[model samples]
Target: MLNFLKKNAALIWAKKHVQKAEEFKKNAEKNQDELLLSLVDTAKKTLFGRTYDFENIQSVKDFQGKVPVADYEDLKPYVEKVKRGQRDILWIETPEYFAKTSGTTSGSKYIPISKEGMPFQVKGAQSALFHYIAKKNNADFVGGKMIFLQGSPELEEVFGVKTGRLSGIVAHHIPNYLQKNRLPSWETNMIEDWETKVDKIVEETERENMTLISGIPPWLIMYFEKLIEKNGKKIKQIFPNLQLIVTGGVNYEPYRDKMEELLGGKVDIVQTFPASEGFFAFQDDYTKEGLLLLTNHGIFYEFIPLEQYGKPDAQRLTLKDVELNKDYALILTTNSGLWAYSIGDVVRFIDKNPHRILVSGRTKHFTSAFGEHVIAFEVEEAIKSTVEKFPAQITEFHLAPEVNPEEGLPYHEWFIEFEKEPENLDLFKNELDDQLRKRNTYYDDLISGNILQKLHITRLQKNAFQEYAKAQGKLGGQNKIPRLANDRKIADLLKVYKK
Candidate 1:
């Protein structure tokens, strides 16, 4: 009776919001312009506003001229002031929370979430769920137990405001309606050790009616493997009602095959493009290949061409100017007071009518050792295409440049962990090389010019990535293996895991 009531209420909400979303999609361009002006108008009295002359910034070009494109380093001075309890340094008021982020390579950087801006993060998530419900014409998943595999919600006071991982901080804001259905128990989730937390999560959820499970792919893989091992049953058998999987932070294609294998069948996947900076985009249309870019959200975006990034003559374009399939460095001026901030992410538009995009790669996280800059999208797509022909079950993989080899020319090295490797490894490698070459012309030229050898693959033992993550103290919770690096830092560390 309770579940039935929940589903009906959710469906009603979905219908209303779905219509609003369509309206937003139709006026995306106008909405972006209005949002930009509104953000500037709101901050016109703040410290940054006075410095950038936000009052005189009447147009996009005016604003762009007033404020240069900024990265974290550029804003660090302002961020430091905010940390010292200085008000209106960036935003008008004090931040509601400081989302502490720790990447695999970088140290903790605190990203401010203002009271006005914070709701958009929560709303983006709620809107995604509502859209899914409306599209499917069902909210059955809400009726069953749902679990979000995330960080500990316990937060510390940073100066005066709340501080923790983005996921951890978001946990505090879970809607009252979801509190009843959400699982793993507050106690289990608070466990700091990821392995222990996963074990506890399995114990708490394996026997429940889990219909929707949400997490990054790598962590979910860990949870699924443990559950299967414990019961000697597929995930579907354990959670018969399980129907939906929500994923973000990383690409979903590489893990799709492995996840389906673990589940013993297919489940609906709703890929989201979210981060501490902002909840940017989410999968609204199941039929589409890319996520629907949120136009009405408190973010005004600047798409800088990937080639022209960081250059003085680089073009900065608004939504109307972006072309489909071309890579762009995603920059944001948002409600959080980020002004032309390059969040280091790269995206490509797949559709223009509603502006659906695919997260292509990161600006700083690609291989450019020999001027052959191989991106995450290219490598993942190449592997995806190669695996279609070769039949390989990839657990995880990473690529790094091999600058100094024992003998012969330098080459790109692939460290792959496989559940089921191809029958003919040599043929599989050749096909993979060909796929990569087709996608990346610089690599092909290097190979043709004999400047680099064919890419080499070092087969890694099972649980290699897991072991590597555990070694780094980042086994779970949003930390993903870097796709490619210019340096061999990760490659050298992964050498021991090679079979």
Candidate 2:
């Protein structure tokens, strides 16, 4: 009777939310201008608002003209003030907490999370699952445990505000009724050590009926490895009822084959684009190629073309102005007080009707030092192709420019940790080089001109990335090995583990 009631309630919840999501899409399409104007008007009372003269801004053009696109460094002072318990600094009031994320080019970032902004994050997550359920026409998974392999929820107080990982904060706010179906209790989740937490999770969920799993791909892979090691069975064998897998943070293309191999069967995947700043997008339709942008959410977005990213007087465009297939660096002006914030991510719009996007790469995570611009998507595709052709699997990899004046010619240095090493390493390296050349015309041109030499592949010892991440205090949850770097910072660090 209890199980029946729970399942029925879950169905009702999903049904209600699915209708709201549809309504939201319709409303956004019809009233985008009105919504943005309302957002500006609502925020006009805040500190950032007052300083920017939001009260006088009558249109998107005026708002764009008044506010400059800002990176984290530009807003750090305001964030610091909020950290010290200052009120009415950026938002109407101080943030309820801050989410600390490892910055790519910069150091640690503290993103403000206001009370009003919290619901959007929660609703975004819930709507993602609800959309999946509505599309697949199956809510049976809700009756079983859904494990979210995430960070610890135990927050460290920054002045009066509680700050922690965004995932941790979201985990702490999971609806009370759904608590019965969630795995790894609060006590287990609060464990600081990732390895220890994984052990405890394996122990706790080993016998449970785990139907759904959600997390970043690498950490999910780690958990699966541990589970298989303990039980001597594949994931599907262990959890016969397992139905869906949702992943994001990094591109899922590279990890797809490996994950399927471990699961022992085809598992449905739903991708999401969740950041500490806000829950931006989610895979709404299984048939669709890109994630549907959460338009009606509390966040307002702008985009600058990739070519115009660092250039002064670059065009900052709103949703109405974006073109399909062009790469654009994402900018956000949110309810949480991020005014025209450049969040460093680049994306391409695939559809405009419902606003679907494909996350292409990061602003700082590309290589163009030698005029051979290589984005993360291109690199990832090349890696995927190389792995498919060879009998090798990459555990982790990083590519950096080798541009020493003393060296004869500039080249891309690939530092790779392989799970299954190819019998002929030379062939593997050549294949990777050929694949990348085929994909990127600029890189091919440079190689043809002899201005850039062929890629140099350096094989690192097993578990090198894990050791490096541990050393940097960034092992597990959300933190990832940056696949491409413009400089040799990551390459230099990985040099210590060269085989």
Candidate 3:
């Protein structure tokens, strides 16, 4: 009863505010620079001398380029201070919740998320929703049960804290009005609660009349595949109204074809960029090539050239100063208590009016085993192109790095699952390897130097990737087999099922 009330209330509020949100976007775009600067000033006042090293940053004579580049590590001192209950580190007005991010192998980065921080994320989320509404121009369709496959409950002191990283934070801010009947009750929490409630989560989602679903691509893909396997041809028939499918957290271009095949339709996937710090952008319109940066919300954006991150004299430019089509590393200052924070994402301006950006890839999620650095986006594109050339139906794929210890020759081994046997498998592999070399100059250079071998493609029968993921204990919802693994050790772990 409470959930129902929240859903209806949220819908009513949305009906009243959707137009204004659209107007806010247009106005923000028209007066981009002034609004951005004003927001930055507000952030400085709200966070400076409180949550971060504001005086040190403000003291820099050349604020643009003089301030040193910061990774997540740079903020550790401040976070540690906060964790230790030091009153001097921050002056948080109304402390609410902290959002955890998937940290680098070690632990997790718990970012303090406040109520002030939520409005911005809400804006981005709503903007994406408005875009979806505008696409079909069906404002009435917003009234339905939306199920977000996010994190589950975790032990927090005496009670189980219901959350998981970004998904958890998103869940946390699920406007007080939208919590009742409109929201699906099932939680696709991460590995934290998977051991006990995996079957239960599947049962709840399968039972609920879930109209809207949003999650990371790999997880959604795995879930739908599981549904097909479990229910046979009755899968799609069960969730006929499950229309809108929103995803981010990974690149979707390479997996789109496979996902469409599995889901049985071209599901609307609104790509978004949500980090531990804040929600950055969302695809505002269906046809747009890039996502609209939530310029008016929680974040103040800054960009430096990818080549200039480490340089002592690299200029950190604002939105007004960015060059379109050029790759730049994103540095953000957000209302969520993070200042001049480096989110480790690389983006390029795709549209100017609405300030849309294309998230190319992560700065460090790359392979440089052969001196030729192949970023995630490049490898994904290469794999997609290679898969398309084959006449056989490709089910799933993974690219693993192969580095020789003795001779130091490095190359990538491709593992693929296909529906049928290819006519000329060897020739196809050679052509794909040639395509990779031609597309990436670094790979070609490594090939010429005898440092990288020609690509080796191995085709597995259907469900190979799924079985591999299950073996890794990454089955059920929200778990996916990573398309690219950087090291041979991680690669071997991912491919332990190879006979």
Query: TM-score winner among the candidates?
Result: 1
TM-score against truth, every candidate: 0.98, 0.95, 0.82
The better-scoring model by TM-score among 1 and 3 is 1
After aligning candidate 3 to the native by TM-score, how far in Å is the CA of 305 from where it should be?
2.1
lDDT for residue 385 in candidate 2, whole number 0-100: 94
Off by over 4 Å in 3: 1-62, 87-91, 139-141, 153-164, 182-192, 195-198, 392-400, 405-409, 417-423, 448-451, 458-482
- The Cα local distance difference test for each model comes to 0.90, 0.87, 0.63
lDDT by residue for model 2 (285-339), tens: 8656899899888888889999899898899887878999888999998878888
Clash number for every model?
0, 0, 6
Candidate 2's TM-score reads 0.95
| Number of the top lDDT candidate | 1
The best-first sequence of candidates by TM-score reads 1, 2, 3
User: For model 2, how many clashes?
Assistant: 0
Tens digits of per-residue lDDT, candidate 3, 426-478, equal: 87788777777776787888788777778777666556766676676665444
Q: lDDT of candidate 1?
A: 0.90
| lDDT tens digits by residue: candidate 1, 38-62 | 9999999989999999999899999
